[model samples]
Target: MDVLAVSIFVFFFLLVTILGFAAARWRRADNLDNLDEWGLGGRGFGTFIAWFLIGGDLYTAYTFIAVPATLYAGSVVGFFAVPYTIVVYPIIFLFLPRLWSVSHRHGYVTPADFVQGRYDSKPLALAVAVTGILATMPYIALQLVGIEVVLQVMGIGVDEGSWLVGHLPLFVAFGVLAAYTYSSGLRAPALIAFVKDILIYTVIIVAVIYLPAQLGGWDAIFSAAQGSFDAFNTENADAIAAGEVGAKGSIPPAAAHWAYASLAFGSALALFMYPHSVTGVLSTRSRSVIRRNAALLPAYSFLLGLLALLGFVAIAAGVTVAGDPPNPQLAVPQLFENEFPSWFAGVAFAAIAIGALVPAAIMSIAAANLWTRNIYKAFINQDATPKQEASQAKIVSLVVKFGALVFVLALSKSFAINLQLLGGLWVLQTLPAIVLGLYTRWFHRWALFGGWAVGMGWGTWLAYGVSSPTQAHFGGPLVPFPGTETNVYIGVVALLANLVVTVVLTVVLRAMGVDEGTDQTQESDYRADAGDEGVEEELDLTAPAHG
Candidate 1:
């Protein structure tokens, strides 16, 4: 073990741990036994705090590890992340403020809570809640995967022995995370996000500037990466032709244009659909805060682009991994180790590990809120008190984190990754029920439910049938469009089918004079801000859900 690096890492880890617990007092509330206080930091975060918190939530450790890894591994489409992030901000700027207004107006803690109020269909609300939980699990597991990668790179836990011995450090780290998250709730991550974003920005900015100078500049880095890819392609010409290996390139080929665009567009649509993203949006102080952050958050997209270029820097620097096929996930961490001093490398590692912590905490909190509001309160106890609901959410947060830890430890890392991909596809299916419901009630509640079912089934089927050079099934995100050679994101295809089914079924249901459930929301609700008549600065447990 590198003692200097490990010591610095431990220092930062301990610092964040203290902050995580101390956060409960940062924005201290009289009663912490409520969803608004625990699950959303009292719904009072301003523009500055929300910027870091949401950035930390959306641009996760997995993005830090996986995006660069994809570029380092020569996946041309991996850069789609930059564009998708850019696209999402505009979309969110338009719609997310409305969600914030409505959520704040109704005291909706989760997207499913909004859905229930909008459609008045328990089954539809339950479907969204279940999907959020399922989609969020693999996502949390991937964050652990990010932590595991950094730990391995730091030489902290690579022993060849019993699983427990190898993963002991990971277990310790996870324990600290679960403890603070359970204790402080959303405040833990919202506070820790300040450190996480600073470190990430410091690390990425330094790496992009310092490493490119060391590698002779961007031109040389690109040339070196391209030459490396050309050499590999020549050597594996037979395998490439036989479809046993993929061709490497800095740019997508003609056939991949649709794939690139579709992935970007599809992911942009799916980004805010995740419970964690909605949780971040709703936690802000007002609709204006949400809109302001939308403009500010794209700064992260610029950072992400710079970070993705590090993959080329890694190639140019000749960073290598120790696996038969060579794991690309090690490229960024190994780059730091080989290129930076021991102390700074430790700081970088801490950034990654803490990056994992912020998102994991928020994800668990969001999933817990989903369970407490949409599942436990909706079904188990119709008249649950705020304290009872908060109690359930706090407990469920721990359970969610533990389940994710088990998921990462007990399963293959590749399996965890595959499931994360499916998670995006699954979560995107809920867009109609949530986003559409925000604007128009033209969609029949049962039709939205049917659409969700169709999208979920079709998207899973498409993802399952995908194949790559390394794996036979569920290997990648892009698949051939129906009756066309062009490849597109499976989520897009599934969403199209979902819209078709929803539209046709809505007309049929309306023509048959089906009973559309009562909408508990009003036009003014979508425009309400903080201090509006019905929007309380503090949640009143005794207040009726709807007036």
Candidate 2:
């Protein structure tokens, strides 16, 4: 049964890879030389593909595994992901069009590029670059977590093989991912998002619909899940009590209103700041495209709410497994394997694996854009050609993927999850730099760095202090309540600190007559269309690609 499921999973993944590499020709662009074409799909994806691409990129295998797993573990905080996503779309709706217009006008593929072009401040751009890279690494590692959870549930691992067993799966997973990503650039994953989302939707919708009937229905599932929650909180009630105050350094304890609000708010701020999400937003051809996506993207958030409940559904359905990790990330996959036919389970597994592919490609591409503009073009080769920059991006992307792969294999699985919590910590720190930088350049560049530094330091220190049953010192989400044993997300708390520092420092810096960096854009540029000043000119490529 496991072998049959594995084969089906392999077959579908292969198909996606073929389709991925085939994307270079999907739209059939004249020249893929410019970053505009390769990085942002020529800045011209319409609504349908844009929806799936953004949705597929945002809702990855980690989401599939991790959301349900959070429910499974009786930690309500995991459920915060749903509301957080829900709120994020509306927030994006408010800001994304402005960002789209500015980025498109400036021919910027990354937020850092925009920061560099907008403020004309090298240090500020560099800070955005470094923050993006740091935040994205753990996110990429989280993709590996989704895949790993699927592998573990499928009962496939290295215990049996001499050479091909332990290392082969990793090699194969990355090799195909790397191959297709390099070949297709953004288009591969953008095109393939349609299939990935469909499979995920079908598998999840079917599972949620059918599993309840098989397990006695929604009432039964809910009651059973509630029972588990009661048991978990009672047994580990002390820890749950401490989470409300601190949110330690990551997320708050899932026990009450504050937990949901923090998760929703913190994730809302962090989501747009992440490079992959920005990549998807930046790829659209026009401001209208971004606005439409902002409004429609919330539809995906609705699906996420249903998906979060599945953890409780799994719990209530009396699902059980052997040798399970004490994490919720595994709940959905384990539930499917326990409750469904192997053939159907294969479909679920494929949904997760392919889900990982879309965002992984987008993330690698976004990270590559950062490297090309911020590092390579900005500092290393100010006079690089378009083709040269494109080629350089391709190479750097491979290194980034491998670096994440090393982070995955080196860190303990438990530690990796906490690292994502820390990613939330770092990504939130970029809000003032990227998202706020969109509206006003009122704050000084040096002040922005100061706020980021303070927030990051406090967040890291708090996160380092958290402990859980399986590991110690940065092993669990940080919490603050004392006697009652509650917890809060560290990122939310740290973000508060960041905002304070940014506000206070901005005022101080302003009073001190600091050079707050020049704003290259006026308020009008945020609403500019395709024909405006500094908008991309279709110049002959015979010259260089530098601005």
Candidate 3:
């Protein structure tokens, strides 16, 4: 073990764990007996806290590890992440304020809650809740992947004997995370985000600037990356011919342009649809906070752009893939291990591990809210009280985190990787019902459901048929663009299919006089903001904590 690195890592981790538990009282509510207090931090985070929380939550450790890993494993194509994030803020900026306004006015806790209120269809709300939960399972698992990668690079948890021994440290790390998250709820992540973001920015800024200079310069890095891609092409010619140009330059070739653009656009649309993303938005104090953060969050996208380039930086640093079977996720972490002192390496590792915790906490909370509000309360216990709901959410959040732990450990790492890819595809199917429905209720609720089914089916089928030299079927996100030999993002194709089905079925269903459910929302509600007069009074959390 790298004793110095491990010591520093433990110190920072224990500090964050302390902070996570203490956050329950940071902006302590009188009581924590409702979704508002527990699930959303009383829906009162200001602009400053919201910025760090949302930024930290969305740009997760999985992102930190995966974006560079993709770039390292492939090349230019992985850069779709950069453009996608750059465009996502603008897309969310256009609609999220309205969502924040209406949700606050109606006391909605999850995206599913808004769907149920807007469409007045419990089935549709359940669908949204289920989708959110399903998509989030793998996402939460991938966060653990980020932590595990760090642990492995630190020369710990490499035991090849029992699987339990191999992942014990990871379990211990998440055990602490799950504990504090259960105690503090949204506040845990919101408060811990401050330290996570500061460490991440420091590590990223120092690495990006200092590493390039140490490795010669940007020109050398680019040249080395190109040389590496050339070698990859020569070795994997068969893969390239099978529509998998696994390596390329900083700019995509003409043949791959559609794939790049569609991936970028599809990811942009799906970014805010994730339940965790919505949780972050709803925690803020006002609609203007949502809009201002939209403008400000691009700072993260800029940092992500820098992070993606680290893959190329790895190539220039002569960081070789080192394992029985090479793991590309190690590119950035390994680069640090090779170049930095053990203490700073520990700091970078702590940054990544904490990065994972913030998002995992938020995601588990979001999933739990979905379960409590849309599933348990909606069906299992319709008369559940505020205290009961909060209790159920806390219990469910713990279950979700442990479930994700099982998912990562029981399955192959390859399965975890593929699930992350599919998570976006599956979540994007909700756009018609959630995003577009926010503007116009033209969609028949059943039609939206039908569209969701078709999009999910078609996307999964196409993804199953895609093959590459490394793996058979479901190889990557790009598939053949309809009516052209070129590839496009499967999520976009699925989303387009989803939209088409919804449009066609809406016209038919309306013409045939099928019932369109009542919309519980109003135009004025969509315009409501903090301190709006007609907004419902928040549940009185002043009652003592009740089991």
Can you give the TM-score per candidate against the true fold? Answer: 0.97, 0.90, 0.96
How do all the candidates rank in terms of lDDT, highest first?
Answer: 1, 3, 2
lDDT of 2 by residue, 367-442 (tens): 8889998999999999999998888888877888898788778877766677777887887888887788888877
Please, what are the lDDT tens digits per residue for candidate 1 over residues 1-547? 8899999999999999999999877767776799998999888788899999999999999999999998999988869999999999999998888888898898899999999999999999999999999999999999999999999999877787777888898999889999999889998999999999999999999998899889899999999999999999999999999988999987999989999999999999999999999999888888888989999999999999999999999999999986768999999999999999999999999999999999999999999999999999998998999999999999999899999999988888889999999999999999999888889989999999999999999999989988888788899998889999899999999999999999999999999999998999999999998888978666322332211
Off by over 4 Å in 3: 235-239, 242-247, 536-547
- Best-fitting candidate, scored by TM-score: 1
lDDT of 3 by residue, 1-547 (tens): 7899889899989999999999888777887789998999888777889999999989999899989887787656888888889899888988999898889888899999999999889998999999999999899999998999999888888798877888889989889999999899998999899999999999999999899899898999888988888888888888777765555566788988888899999999998999999999998878888899999999999999999999989888888866757888889999999999999999999999999999999999999999999999999999999999999999999999898898778888888888888999999999899899889988999999999999999999999998865689778888997888999999999999999999999999999999988899998988897778755334223332321
- Candidate 1: pairs in clash: none
Model 2 superposed RMSD (Cα): 4.4
- Candidate 2 regions with alpha-carbon error over 4 angstroms: 160-164, 231-255, 322-327, 476-488, 531-547
The full ranking of all candidates by TM-score, starting with the best, is 1, 3, 2
Model 2's alpha-carbon lDDT is 0.78
Tell how far residue 375 is off in model 2, in angstroms: 1.3
